[model samples]
Target chain A: MNADPTRLLAREMAARLRTGETTARALAEAHLDAAERQNHALNAWLVIDRDGALRQADAADAVLAGARRDGPGALAALHPLLGIPVGLKDLISVEGGQCTAGSRILEGYRAPYDAHIVERLRDVGAVFLGKTNMDEFAMGSSNEYSAFGPVSNPWDLDTVPGGSSGGSAAAVAAHHVPLSLGTDTGGSIRQPASLCGIVGMKPTYGRVSRYGIVAFASSLDQIGPFARDARDAAALLHAVAGRDARDSTSAPVPVEDELLHLPESDDEAVAWLRGRRFGLPREYFVAGMDPDVERRIHESVAFLVDAGATVEDVSLPHTDYGLATYYIVAPAEASANLARYDGVRYGLSRRLEGGDFIADYLATRGEGFGAEVKRRVMLGTYALSAGYYDAFYVKAQKVRTLIKRDFDEVFASGIDALVAPTSASVAFRFGARMTDPVSMYLSDACTLPVNMAGLPGVSIPCGLSEGMPVGLQLIGPAWSELMLFRAARAFEGLTAAATWRNLEPAQLAEADDAAGPTPAERAAALAAAR
Target chain B: MAGLSRSDVEHVAHLARLGMTTAELDRLEGQLNHILEQYMKLAELDTDAIPPTAQTIELENILRDDVATPSLPASAVLGNAPAREGDFVIVPPILGGDAG
Candidate 1:
């Protein structure tokens, strides 16, 4: 208990809780205090439920006390995540709480019931600190598209924490919480984790049920975990992943128990890396990649080679077509999913007296959605319109097949995983890519192909590039999450004593200053300067 | 793949049921055209033999038992309705009126 509880990993905190050195309530209080104090500058959280978190923490404490009284068998049956604090992306439903999904359309809407993941987390006795900010409808690469405000990276207050899971990434990166949940459509989780310097994984499609989570691009969307390290991320993913009868798409594959017990010793973890074959996708290192980022990735590959792993250059031939294919497919699905937001049902309603329903629908959606959302909806509608379906929507789907085949061929060649940079560049300043839509989309170039292939991918901090964190991504074939986590854990062990591993977010002290300018103020000042 | 014209943009917006002002439409025309240009890259690949992949996983035709379960309370479901009466939500007239 002598160590700062907020700084300890969730696993370390679990160990503390087991030995009676600290209670769940104390850990929750420490995180909530840090979140509340730092939120003025970070703007990471949309709402921090102080009362609700404490209630959950007290419940966890009671269970811990009872298990202690009931002897060794009862204690052995407890979940490791019991009493851990977690941040949830605003898109995930937590009953009776606001689920805005960062859009004005859902500004005041409260979820009627818990999402499948929320139910799972609650059953394991995890504390929900609050909901975090995100891009509206999970549409943008930068958090600036959020109607509420942008999220500032903990490393540098001037730069963005990548989106649409920016708030969750920043919350974990800033030590407000050890773990969080985020949904990835096309690099929403991995890109943000790369920018914020944390661990994020997008489980294979249908690996995690999406029963009550907000729909972004139905075919591509998957909920995943964000944590400071691979083991904690693996633990979070294990708690929520598996079959759910409600979501027909949730795969029936057995949830692996090995996720809960990743190799703890350095030697054991490194042994998993030896003799593993990794494919370095030549296409992932594109022309616009920052030299600093390329250097870090090469250094990481060399470290893997030194540990008895083989790295070879590989080609995903259809990789260039991935961006265009994803843009069409995701938006087309989004348009259909978003068509439910008419004036009558649940969200914002803009009906005028005696006005036709068509006008009402038009007004409600037009005003409710932000610029980026409207853009996607417009593109989708145009593509799906008459005389364009085959040329756009159907063509994107066919191209998607080629993208998947690229990954399949590489994995078929006996490659255990594909190693690549998570993002082409480090976090950029706010208002940097805001003006050009294509530039914003390019932020996810290196990571979106995995989503297209429906494979599991993880991003872990490799090192710093130009004083900003660079992420090394490992993508594996479907249902290879256990292998992916083992590899990520091995990399963590390999780089444990590196100088950059000891570094914390540079601007965290500034974020803690009460008088500092809020993210909204900084955004406005930047706009004025432009 | 030609760029969308102003009238085309307006028509698509109408189909999507989104109200757009002249300024919004004007900006959207350029933006949408730029994005369509990006989509033009998909044309470079000849996927005539490739099958379209709508869903990535192998699981399909998932079915469950017909047993019924308790549903959400009507009160909770209706609580979010913008305008509602007892067990009913108010809506604009769908017939016998000018559509716009």
Candidate 2:
């Protein structure tokens, strides 16, 4: 809202780069310097490509100069993020780059080819700032389970930033990179983004290519942008979004130019109920939800109502089944996906002699995986075990259908989108959920249902409680990303509070230096730390 | 159904791979059982008529047209392998006796 160049969004930053106010090389060098200085405190980046980045930035400058001589090159070259710095979650592959997925098993594993999204970003001249930390294999909600080490909250070091996309959120929040991509399966992106107080989008399933993103839950993983705001996120989406031949599940549609010449709105949000409808799913307001969070949701709804959107109480009785269903389905996929990590072909190989082939498989996997990853693999293996398959895994799948149907019913009933608190409460302290696995899983309650239903969801800064950020989630029907973006933008516009905007480095330093045992090195650090 | 036996815990540990002490296994068994029990909530729902959903988006014919695209050079593909033998990406042998 202010005219300050320092706080300008990424889109504005890119515009200045294109206008030659600052060269792409200068912006890259400055951000790289900032990242290097802050990395000791933040621990957000797994690798910062000082040499590779400068080379890429120099290339972008050359491209921009040539484009000036001619016109902005083709759509591939004229892309908005052409020279912007992007930190990718290690889960996504970038050819010739180390893609560890924040795991010891994947350590030193360089991809032979770029992921479809990586290819797009490279074609547009995006400077890759290497990989950010994530929950190993994208299994956890908080980023505490990374093999690289826990990424501290940019706001308060005592607290978590949020996981499995915690590093991406923290990097963007701390201004290390203006844009980063993270995969969300069961609130991985949105929850961390919410906790970190930045913008995150989990596009409708298949909206973004998942070809080279390391599988956690194949069915649920969708890579989306984490940016300063919705408009910049929309622009990043335009550059990297769309179908890819590598990802069969990618949507067969053209990327949306949704942010072009977008009109500015002064009013935060006027919840116009004239013809638009918003549903408040009762199941989202569970017992353990913080009272402060409930209050913020109420305020957000009021702001939406003032912005002219109609609000009504709705029932998603099947919502209670989501956590159970997610655990089963996600683990089942995790089991199948992680089977490739046997030390034979790739990953860590332990030495043994005269052992049975199966024994070697057992030994290699046992040593390669961390405790949490093993737990999920075991759960998945058990669920898909022959005798129990019909009972557990099959049953979970059936429940998943019901969850999707619940959303469908509401959308069909005239509601353009549904709104709920992104998480039941604000972020907890670093070790709050460490020993409580069930309670930890339950934190995804408000966010998981959207992924189950394959709907587009955006978590925008709605309000704050107890000095931490709380996000209001807006969910739209399949392929209705535009509507979700529009609604979220409107709500984001209406909320004049800068409560969830940025995190200062002082907060990170305080959290890291405070008296405490050194945080878990890697395995525990992978889960998002929100 | 109940807390894991020492042998069962050992088996899982063997399957997962970090060397754990007996105390660590005992603690893990307790935590894993508690989690497995909580997840049993899926067993309560009657999903008899519902269809299993592997993917939420409804898209048809996900196959791409068969086209011969340019391939990565063999050098780049095997370049980063920690252990490589000639044209092959060498690995620490699966049978794992010693350097092969």
Candidate 3:
């Protein structure tokens, strides 16, 4: 109770709730207050549902009251996430709430029903703070591609929080929420988590059902969690991951209870790392990696080595091809998934009085989609066009097989997980990589291969680079989320006493300034200055 | 690995049902070509014998009981429609009309 509730971890808040030291309503109010007060500068949330969150919080309080009246067993049976405030990426549908997917096309589209994850979270009594901002249709690497505006990294007011789950990362990083949900197609979750300095994991493909959530790349997209630590991230992942009959792709794998019971003791957690073999992908340390970022990753790896883990240089030879392969594969799936955005059905509509349906479609789509979305749709269409299907789409898929094989071979060699830098560099300033799309795409170089291989990957803060946070990523084979979380928790245990681990995001105070320029204003000023 | 020309960009945009301005098309032509150049790296690997991986997780033919479930209310579904007439959504003429 002495510490600020907003700054405390969700699990800590849950513990407080269990002991009657704090109420769920008090926790929800603390986060909502911070989120609303700082939103002008951070722009992390598109909506902050004060009323809805309070309602959920009150319901949680009632449940706690009932459990208290009963017995210790009933109280202990409560979900750890009950009463936790969670910010959902805009694409995750909450029934009757706007599901923009960060696109003008979906500007006013209220989801008719809750997404599967939303239903799951609601069932566990997790309070929904509101929808967070994101790249339009989850296409861009920088949150700048969001049609609404960019999300600022709480570490630095002018820098990006990474994307397209930027808002979720920023929200958690800025302490607006202790946990949030984000989807990863090609490093959307991990890269932003890296940029914002939090724990993020992209569960193995189909580990989490996608029914009712907006689609980007069908084969690659997977929902995951963002938390300040690995255990909380694991708990969030446990809440929503598993089979859903609606989404045929949702794997029927058993959700692990071990996820809920990650070792809490520092000594016990560190022991899990002993004798575990970690592979450092040689291709991940590419030419343009920032020196500070590289140093942090190496230091983290050395720490693992010192802790009795064997670190070996391994090659995911097809890593260089990940960028190109992902560009093609994701955009192709995006184009197909986005075709439902025609004017008449739902979302933004443009109808020329005498114009035909094709014209209506053209006008609606052209005007509705943002620059990055349009570019992706164009690339996808051309790739799938006549005389080019084999040369492009099919070719990309074949190379995807090679990418997956690279991970398979390394894991087959007794490597428990691959350790690497989550992002090649720390968070960059807004408009830094905006002009050149390829440069922006390169932001995800180190992490995208995991998505290509359908593996579970976690990005946890290792240390700081140039006064900003840097992430150390751990990737494991498909359905190895439990192993990855264990490794991440072990790394957290090892780094618990480190100076950088004790530091909060630097610019949060500045983000609380009510008179400061909004993220949109800052972006416009940057553009005008350029 | 051929670069997308201005015409190719325009044609593809049309096929994708996007009405683009000349300036947008001009920028896209160059950008699309540059991105394609990145895809050119995939050619470095001869994947002739490698089977394409369309889906990664190997989940096949997921089936469930055929029993019908209650669907979303028509009113709820229609609430988002831009133009709706009673139970149906209105659309621009698609057949037997001048292609404007």
Alpha carbon lDDT of each predicted model:
0.93, 0.77, 0.93
- Which scores better on lDDT, 2 or 3? 3
Model 3: how far residue A29 lies from native, Å: 0.8
> In model 3, which regions exceed 4 Å deviation?
A528-530, B98-100
Model 2 Cα shift for residue A30 (angstroms): 1.9
For candidate 1, give the DockQ: 0.82
After TM-score superposition, what is the CA distance of residue A36 in candidate 2 from its true location, in Å?
A: 1.0
Model 1 ranges with Cα > 4 A deviation:
B97-100
Each model's DockQ? Answer: 0.82, 0.43, 0.82
Task: In model 1, state the lDDT of residue A128.
Answer: 99
Q: What lDDT tens digits, residue by residue, belong to model 2 across residues B1-100? A: 3445767667655554445556656777777778677667776877777778878777887665688988889787666654578878654434545653
Clashing pairs in 1: none
Compared with the true structure, model 3 gives a TM-score of 0.99
